[model samples]
Target: MTNFFDQFMSPTYLGVPLMALALTLPWVLYPTPSSRWLNNRLLTLQAWFINRFTQQLLLPLNTGGHKWAVMFTSLMLFLLTINLMGLLPYTFTPTTQLSLNMGLAVPLWLATVIIGMRNQPTIALGHLLPEGTPPLLVPILIIIETISLFIRPLALGVRLTANLTAGHLLIQLIATAVFVLMSTMPTVAIITATVLFLLTLLEVAVAMIQAYVFVLLLSLYLQENV
Candidate 1:
């Protein structure tokens, strides 16, 4: 209400933690399967989508990596839910906050690196130095690789935050222009509204894609360690 940035800030009511509520709200939207032999169309479709997504996501992973299925699935659904829900009117998007995104990225990324180090320290540490490097460049290459490794989490959080924030800002700006020009420039207002609609659709696709990419990247990190 105060400014455009206000919309992206974590919402609060009185003293309640609305961000937690938003995070959990997506679970309520999903339906639970019944014990009966037959399933409803919604349940069937949901199951099918999740199944196919999981299969595809894990395709490149080893059997050892299969242990992460539940985590990966839950995370994917959580992210996908919050992202889509955030697109709705009068709702807050938790993923757009760099703090929240980094909270997720750091832990998951650390887990992958830890797994690699524990299971195969030789190979894990080896990532910091590529194979067959010239004797003179080993230290420089190690430093570069180490920096790159640490940058992964920062990149993940920033990427998600920046994408969602930019999309939201663009939509808000266009919608504002549409309102401001409606009386004096009816034709232009209509054109702006149309652009807003198309942009909204693109943002929706972006929401889905970003969620998948976040999980996909995590899976890839796990793959290296496994």
Candidate 2:
């Protein structure tokens, strides 16, 4: 049987890497802002969207955290673009790979933790143990909190990877069923095809939301530290 999971593999052309091309494709999709007085529809829409998204993302952060405005917004747009692109037929979704997600998650998360440690070491270390804890459970709570702290990045990466992976797998399974049932069961195949169309729409929404959620959670972590 063909492995359903093979869809997630990075595409290659003559043994050369195409993952880099897939990863960079999102940047080219955006229309560059021109120096003219009037703006095109695409540029106007892009600017408006970025402005609104930036405002919402930074609403919870303090002034200090505002420094991350550019990085966070850019990250959101990149993820959003790549995700939607993946929904297209014969395209690879880089975010579906755990390595890419973790690579993004760990460093960003570590930066937040480092900011906390550098700016206010006392408060950062105090996060391990809560105020007014009973003496007996103090050590246990410390251990538990420490474990939880370390697992944040893992949680972030796994959440993104699993969501996209499951969606893509369901899409493939249903698509395969539609093809298989077409000749033998025309009526059922039609129904399956309709279901596939609906699922595709849902996956598009999932793509956008998961990207936002990934960035949102990072912002929340930043809020705590800053």
lDDT of 2 by residue, 66-183 (tens): 9999999999999999999999988899999999999999999999999999998898999999999999999999999999999999999999999999999999999999999999
* Runs off by more than 4 Å, candidate 1: none
What is the per-residue lDDT of model 1 for residues 108-174, given as tens digits with 9 covering 90 to 100?
A: 9999999999999999998898889999999999999999999999999999999999999999999
Model 1: how far residue 63 lies from native, Å: 0.6
Off by over 4 Å in 2: none
Residue 129 local lDDT, model 1: 88
171 Cα displacement, candidate 2 (Å): 0.4
Worst 10 residues of 1 by lDDT: 1-10
lDDT of each: 0.93, 0.95
